[model samples]
Target: MQALLNVILPVFIVLGFGYLAVWRNWFSQAGVDGVMVFTQKFAIPCLLFNAMANLDLGQSFEWRLLSSFYIGALSGFALGVWGARYLFSRDWQDAIAIGFCCLFSNSLLLGLPITERAYGSGALTANFAIIALHSPFCYGVGITAMEIAKARESGGRASFFKVLKAMFSNAMIVGITLGLIVNLLNVELPEPLGEAIALIARAALPAALFGLGGILVQYRPQGDLRVALYVCVISLTIHPMITFALSFATGISVEATRSAVITAAMAPGVNAYIFANMYGRGQRVAASAVLIATGISIVTAWIWLTVLP
Candidate 1:
């Protein structure tokens, strides 16, 4: 059906194109870097702003649903960290890497677009609520996890508040904030500026996805199949499954709740991996985890969509 294709087809196409581009050596890191720069500097801001511009901001947000999702992701992340510590007996860095991977989902690059395609405008708004929570939680919990993990490895401490502030200032967050301001003011971007933002903002997803593909090339796994497998089971399989079970309990609108539930399950959540690697906490492990987790998302997405209410 058109619905499934709209959601499913483009996801693979992007992946496939990324793979081909890499396979053909079409772009260097510099090229990918250029794309990222453009998106982050311009496109992403536009996309975030434009996305908010259309939302009906007055509708009461479902605090319960968002809270449950956030709490569940945090708990799931903590559970993974605890288990990884016991099983791996690894330093905090690796444990935090695993924890962040388990907690974060690919809501922006993959989840939101698909939700928009499948459900419509309101679903996009619902996804926005979930995404708004994602960066703050990931940055906050992730920094704590990283510092805990890193102290053992590097004898250094990470300032959790500093990390939180940095995430709050990230371009995406600024875009969201500014977009909300514009929406609240009942103002639209003027024609010239709006056109530029639209053009640049359109590139954010592709740039991110392509950057993800290129980043995948560096994954060597460090001979830890178990690490990759464990993270996958938690991130790809368990997280969404848990969301669905909770969804069944909530008796919310099936379509909206289902979008959140299944997306939570299928999202690969590359940011966690990025942060983990950046902080010297199992970079290779996080890289491998991200690559494998994202690869699995396509099949898992089909499965989750088919079975979820």
Candidate 2:
């Protein structure tokens, strides 16, 4: 309870405040435009660059741990596929979106802050590894899911392998590649350059949260309360299960890995929905997942600590 009050609740409180602003008509439906620009133009880039550039590549990356995290996430992905197919009566497109929402978590904007808050900077390396590993699934499998979802609209087969090619070429892949290359090379960015990056990274969190607020305000799940509830479960429940299983089974140092699992499982990375919107794959569903999962994670995280050994 204290953890919820001290750490997670503050984030949601701010977000709720944003919702209040929306309710007050402080901004028209169009009022979010400025904040959106600030988020994309500055915050997100900064956050990504800061995380990548400052990554302590000097610290040993435990391949076993990496494999554990990957497999855990992969398991979530598979479950998402099966759940969407047999349970939802959804066509390929909706299933694709549901799977994407269920599996690909918000490991960036929300992940870093929450992990740092709960477990401290010590857990950062593992968090970094988790977020870094998310790309292949997002761009590769997630995008492919979206493409096939769309392909059915045309009554044509979307070659699964071809979608992999498109996924590989996504901008997120390019951004991470560029960031990693610079980091791995041990390039010394001048102080001024580093300052610029820091300025951008600083904006990522507030902009991301506020943007989330704006988006949720814009897209409420009206007709599909059932679908929204379904999203809340997948986004909040099953995803966390995967993270928890991986953290425990891998013998991860308890505090760090547990924190990672709890928070990462809570929300869909904003980028996931951005990619969904880009591909026109169940954008509404993705948006609702991001919103509701993030909303409920506050209580869920509090409960997780109680069960911790």
Leading candidate by TM-score: 1
List TM-scores for all candidates, in order. 0.87, 0.85
Going through the candidates in order, what is the number of backbone clashes in each?
Answer: 6, 5
Q: Where does candidate 1 clash, by residue pair?
A: 43-200, 43-201, 92-149, 93-149, 106-269, 240-265
- Give candidate 1 regions above 4 Å deviation: 1-6, 120-122, 148-161, 185-188
With candidate 2 superimposed using the best TM-score fit, by how many Å does residue 22's alpha carbon deviate from the native? 2.5
Candidate 2 ranges with C-alpha deviation above 4 Å: 28-31, 58-60, 148-174
- Tens digits of per-residue lDDT, candidate 1, 1-309, equal 544576767866776676667667887756766766776667766788787666676552476566556666876687778877888787666787778878888878778666766666466666776766577667778776666555666777767677767678777887878877887888966799878878877777777766666656666467667877788888777777667666667765676576677668755566766677677676666777777877777777767776764
Candidate 1 weakest lDDT stretch, 10 residues: 59-68
lDDT of 2: 0.67
Candidate with top lDDT is: 1
TM-score of 2: 0.85
Model 2 clash pairs are: 46-201, 47-201, 105-269, 106-268, 106-269
